[model samples]
Target chain A: MNNEKKKITMMFILIATLLFGLVPFILLTKRSGELQTGNMLGILVVIIIALLAAVIGVKRIKDLKQGQPVEDELSKKVLNVAGARSFYMSLYWLLAIMLLQPVIADILFDSEMLDAEQALGGGITGMAIIWFLNWLYYQKKGVN
Target chain B: MKNKIKELRARYNLTQEDLAKKTGVRRETIVFLEKGKYNPSLKLAHDVAKVLKTSIEELFLFD
Candidate 1:
């Protein structure tokens, strides 16, 4: 795509990789008591792999600058509509979870959950379901 | 809202893809418009009307 689009793509890839990959890795590591030598080695390997991925992503973006336009108006509108619907869906999901947290905990997990950790799993699952519902809505609305 | 996009397309011997390209929209959008499942913005309606060699008023019927 164009330079701006390529830059945007690269930025998106970098942020996504950090958010979905590195953040989880760090969080999982933090769950353990103390870092063993093996854990240190694993962290180092992850860092090296992340760096290599960043380098390749940057190179790919640079190469993409000479390609076609990133998105036309209609495609952007489709995304806007789908994203807005998903936003509403997620908002409702959060509200429902907040309202029914105790009931959900009792019914599903059989626990008297009163903390964020207990609700976190359900919240994530709700978000995933919202995303799927948004996809289905888009499909029904004939958004390509 | 209802539109005469399919009728006009057939009259002009233009496929939905051809009309979509001419109007700078996806075929899905055209399909939705023709089926009355989606309403177009004023600009898109004008663009499609222009590509179909018709006026917006003649192309779309609003209730």
Candidate 2:
């Protein structure tokens, strides 16, 4: 199969594996209300499948048989612009949040408003948005 | 940026896919280049010019 087909297949497999793992995890968590071996095993299996899907998807899309370059100059430029724009956008939002953190804490009466994990989650969301927007932009830009 | 790729490819009886294969890039890249929507690197310009048997100056008209 071609790259597109391979990607679709990999996504389907990954989604199926995630759903499969999620059901077991939910059931075990509901049954015990505490950490259990089954729950851990289910999460572990999901992670492994997700990793496998990611690796296979990347390999197929790259089509790197002998270290050939997958991206041309235009693609590289587009990616750079996308990454820079995403970083700036995310940074501006984070700074705004930081500036308002004291006020937010006062309003909520909680000093620990946003933790490092929540900040990381915001960054991840920003990255995901950038990835999708970049894909859309390039798909349109590269059309005949 | 404007390019004479479409005209030159017609002259040489080469399709977009053919040129893309020659230059080791995807067909979408050639489409973008032909439409003057994407600026190529010097190396890519050289490679494309070589494939078309013409110079970059003649193939790509910069304004």
Candidate 3:
């Protein structure tokens, strides 16, 4: 497929591989007390595999960045569309969360829930995650 | 908003990177200008025009 598709597929594959790699640990161990010695090697292997995959993904991105320019008219329009969608919708999502924060906190935690300070911290964290995700998606899919 | 970047670069045979180095803009900024994705600040436009050996009006088409 196209570069966008390839990037998304690679990301999905990486996530799936990571979750699958954790399955054995989840199944075999009930607690830290029950941890087995032999599983250490398995965990190490998973870490290495994850690192290798990350390296491959980063290399792919670097190649794209350094590759010949492709900002033809169509791509530029696509980028603008993508950007408009991402920014507007993502901000809308964030607004919804902020508006619903009290209800969510009351349900998810005791009503002693996050106050302004904690909420602000959590908001910043959420913003960072969303920004990173947006950046990744734009890099993958022409920002549209 | 105005620049003579492409023409100047063509005249000097300087790559975008070379111009970026001389003008202290990121390569991406240079690329952005070349592609017309952005209308840069007056300062940036002037700087680029000055480097490119052309007036801002020559480099940019302001509506």
Provide the lDDT at A57 for model 1.
57
Best by lDDT: 2
Poorest lDDT segment (10 consecutive residues) of candidate 3 chain A: A68-77
State the lDDT of candidate 3 residue by residue for A89-142, as single tens digits: 667767876888878667755464556544554554454445445545554443
Residue B17 alpha-carbon offset, candidate 2, angstroms: 1.1
Q: In model 3, where do residues sit more than 4 Å from their true spots? A: A1-91, A94-124, A134-144, B1-4
State the DockQ of every prediction: 0.20, 0.39, 0.05
Instruction: Name the regions of candidate 1 deviating beyond 4 angstroms.
Output: A3-92, A103-111, A142-144
Estimate, for each residue in B1-63, the C-alpha lDDT of model 2 and write its tens digit: 899999999999999878887898767688899989888878888999999999999999978
Worst 10 residues of 3 chain B by lDDT: B20-29
Ranking by TM-score: 2, 1, 3
lDDT of each: 0.67, 0.68, 0.61
What is the per-residue lDDT of model 1 for residues B1-63, given as tens digits with 9 covering 90 to 100?
A: 787889999999998778877876666677788998777888988999999999999999978
Tell me the docking grade of candidate 2: acceptable
**Model 1 chain A worst lDDT run, 10 consecutive residues:** A63-72
**Superposition error at A7 for model 2 (Å):** 13
Q: For every model shown, what is its TM-score relative to the native structure?
A: 0.61, 0.62, 0.43
The local distance difference test score of model 1 is: 0.67
